[model samples]
Target: MTTPHPTHLRIHQLAGLKPGPKLLVTGAVHGNETAGVAGIERVLKQFDAGELTLLCGTLTMIPIVNPLAHRLQRREGERNLNRNLRPAPIPQDFEDRIANQLCPWLAHADVLLDLHSFNNPGPAFAMMGPRDNDSDLEPFRHEKAEAALAACVGTGRIVEGWLSTYALGLQRRAARQGDGSRQASLVQDPHYGVGTTEYMRSQGGYCITLECGQHVDPQGPEVAYKAILRTLTLLGMIAPGAVELADPNRPIEVLQLYEVIDREHADDQFAREWASFDEVSEGQLIGTRHDGKPVHAPSGGRIVFPNNKAQPGQEWFYLARPSDRKLKP
Candidate 1:
């Protein structure tokens, strides 16, 4: 048998004459979400046509992070490329090999714009990191800067508390096991919550995952394109006023994720067709558990990422409440 070769990522880099913060933009971390790829291509086309110029700093764009998955038009090749996105010592899986190359680039950047699209119907939003904290799992000191950058991304909604809440869910799951021992599985790994943005935060860079819209939504690509231009202008990589930014007076809604519900069985089902951002009342019937028990909402909040096809032991949905955190101007 012949030895297999590792896959490499296609990266586009442009450097300006002046020095500034290094900005990294990535697309299609989940291969099926091609909006980012389309948006990045549009920007590249402008560069080729001499319509856009980088005034300062370095701009690195990886139009497709998971080439194998993208080629197949699937969410992943071996596993979800977005999860556990850190350089691995062994580089075992297909994603691990990709991470080995991706992580160094992440660490070298001053900021990152990870573009993605959701599976459900909802307005585009930005997923940001928590406020500056010393947490060992996912620590960062760029909340204000992240928020400012996010505001210019044309999204009115910002959601935080992803890694921290996932860590909390893992703790609860371990507690339920009653053996005080955690399983040695990908989902159970303490750092399982570490994704592209989380890894960037750990490297001291401001980052945001902009969920453009539904995967197949035609407007998803436009949102991604506008976000890219806005980010370039906001970060001074391009001239100020080079592109239109989000309305300064637009009301920004911040949400903090608090709960992640895992599918306990293959037969678990949602009560109805619930969409992301659908408000759930306290004690409302959210779904039916595998054991024929009703799973009610623990509190009044909005449902996020409601996955009807999640496998057993996978995250089925998440709950979030409005956050009072103030954003910087």
Candidate 2:
């Protein structure tokens, strides 16, 4: 591996005597989410103290992926780093430079675990890639492996259709305009939905974006820590008894995101404060439009990723319905 730029990312690679799958774990892709950072540091400390050892393969950890945003303790130093995460031919922004360094690492991995924390209150859940599909943009052929990995992360809830739904949202936005005008903003980009896990999947690797918990939750770091250990054990990088796995028979709830609501007006307000996974009836009033028109739930389901700070044309929230997909044993 090449030495990274001093200010870009700090990567720690641990190799075992035997060759096995290369696993990459990343944290702090968003500056405000430090649970993954704390968890990764804890694991590194264990390794440094000779308390933990990699039995096989390589373990690469990037505890802080976005250093500038992390230093300022903001979501982004320039723009959201997670959106449109690909190496730039001619780097222009702070995150583009980061992506140039990060994308190579992602492409080299056999597996990826991206740790994150949400703003709105919700249970920890894993965001999964689509099932084996022939979609040229983000073809996913390892759904079973990905599902098993997500199941082992101790998150009882799993959600899918992230890139698919985002793509649909972009299409809707373009159709609403009818004109062929394309904006230069991040959200308006065709590749805006290509985030970390999506990029990993595109590289033919199984990946999971584990949302440990709320940003300020005291137990978020511990959740992330346990998830890291469990993933290491699951991938055979560590011994089985190194960390306790969740019950094999534990029921896992799967949700499929079908709709992404983009903020039409800057002043669009929710009917009340809403959190992720909050259930709503079909006729329930979710919020009010810019013109005082009511926005109600289109169907009976739960809300996901409700961003109260979204700007106009940005994704404000998503609607998800129960999925019948089962995790592989």
Number of the top candidate by lDDT? 2
Worst 10-residue lDDT window, candidate 2: 175-184
lDDT for each residue of candidate 1 in 1-329, tens digit (9 for 90 to 100): 53343367899999888999899999989989999999999999999898999998999999999887887787877787787788889877888999998999999999999999989998999998888788777667887889898888988899989987898878765544432322226667677788899888888888999999999999999999999999999888887765777897899999999999988789999999999999999999999997889999999989999999886666899999999888874
Q: Candidate 2 regions off by >4 Å? A: 1-6, 176-184
Candidate 2 collision pairs:
none
lDDT for residue 260 in candidate 1, whole number 0-100 = 95
- Report the error of model 1 at residue 292, Å: 0.6
**Cα lDDT over the full model 1:** 0.88
Residue runs of model 1 more than 4 Å from their true location after superposition: 1-6, 175-184
Q: Model 1 compared with the native: what TM-score?
A: 0.94
Clashes of each: 0, 0
